[model samples]
Target: MARIGYARCSSEDQSLDVQIARLTEEECQPIRSEKMSGASRDGRTELAAILDFIREGDELVCLRADRLGRDTRDVLNIVHELDQRGAYLTVLDPHITTRGEAGRIVLTTLAMVAEMERRFIKERQKEGIAQAKAKGIYKGGTRRVDREKVLAMHRTGKGPAAIAKALGCSRMQVYRILDACEGAQTAA
Candidate 1:
């Protein structure tokens, strides 16, 4: 059996050191971490990799239940996957493990709490945005990618991949900009 760790931080500005240290203290080797939101399973490539890497008799350790996931369905799916693979999950914060019945129950409860907390966070964020909008202070997220530049590159015979590489963006973004430009032209 192997002990593997997974650490996460919601945003790039956040640090994963604390969670990594805890997992290290637990003697968890080959730890994987990522900077991504746990609000959903989307874009969490490292977590997905860990899920695929774990084998039977392996242990997946994390610092907290929320570190695993903020959605109840996602958490349950992860646990079920581990169970089916004969692997166990160890959460250090509350010291819960899936190796026993009691631990399983506690883990489920903790996951539910985490999901609830996520919902509360979203609600609070929406309220904050609404308040800011009411005060004419909420402008929304800044657009980092220059859609006009992307379209210009495409119009100059640059392919989506080339435009994306030059602009430090994804090909999908380039395609979207080009598509939008085309749609605008057609509408005109």
Candidate 2:
């Protein structure tokens, strides 16, 4: 049986050092980590890789249940998948594991709490943005991509993929900009 570790963070700005250190302290081998939101299981390649390669009797370790997932259903699904593979999930913070019924119960409760905390965070963020707007100090989020440049590229008959490659942005971003420009023209 092996102890494998998985660490995750919501954004690129967040550090995974603490989680990695804790996992190392736990003697977990081949630790996998990623900088991605835990709100959902989508697009989490590292986590998916761990799940795919995990074998029976292997323990999946994380610093906390929230690191595994912020959504209750997603956490539960992960636990279920581990169970099916005869693997276990070990959470360090509350010291919960999926090796027993009690651990499963505690993990479930913690998962629910984590989901609630995520919702509360979103609500607080919305309230803060609203307050900022009321104070006339909210300039809105900074654009990571230049809309005019994207439009210029599109006007030059560049495809979404080509424009994205040239601008160093995702094809989705290029498509969204083009769609918005088209909508604006239709409205005008």
Candidate 3:
């Protein structure tokens, strides 16, 4: 049975070095890493690949339970999936594993803590934003896409997919921009 590792960070700016180093120290092979939010399972292709590739009797390792997922349901679902495949999960930070009944209990408690931590983080962020706005210092999120360029390309018969590809943004962003432009035109 192989021992595989998975590492993740929420955004592109965050570093996966620490997790990778720890996993490597544990002699985990074929480590999978990704830059995506752990709040949900969506858009985590590396995680998906790991789930699909892990075989029976293999151990799936991560630096921490939160690295696997922050939502309790998502984390439980992932563990259930691995269980169904006869694979086990090992969280290194607190050294919890599914190999024992006590580990399962600790893992469940940690999952709930992680979920609560995520909610607390969001609440803190919202409060900070509100305070900043009240102080006239909140400018909100920066726009990565050029609105005029998107509109120009759309007027020239470019589709949302093509525009998104060229602009280095998601198709959903392209659609929102185009839809907003159409709404503005209708209002005019």
Best by TM-score: 3
How many clashing residue pairs appear in each of the predictions shown?
0, 0, 0
Residue-by-residue lDDT tens digits, candidate 1, 1-188? 89999998886458889999888888999999887678888767778888898999999999999999998889889999999899989999889999999998998899899999989998999999999999999999777579888877877998987987798655555676778888999999
Clashing pairs for predicted structure model 2, backbone only: none
User: How well does model 3 score by local distance difference test?
Assistant: 0.90
Clashes in predicted model 1: 0
Error of 1 at 115 (Å): 0.8
TM-score of each: 0.78, 0.78, 0.79
lDDT of each: 0.87, 0.90, 0.90
- The C-alpha stretches of model 1 lying farther than 4 A from their native spots are 143-188
Q: After superposition, which runs of candidate 2 have C-alpha atoms over 4 Å from their true positions?
A: 143-188
At residue 51, what lDDT does model 2 achieve?
97
lDDT of 3 by residue, 36-76 (tens): 78999986778999999899999999999999999999998
Higher-scoring candidate on lDDT, 1 or 3: 3
Model 2 Cα shift for residue 97 (angstroms): 0.8
Q: Candidate 1: deviation at residue 110, Å?
A: 0.8
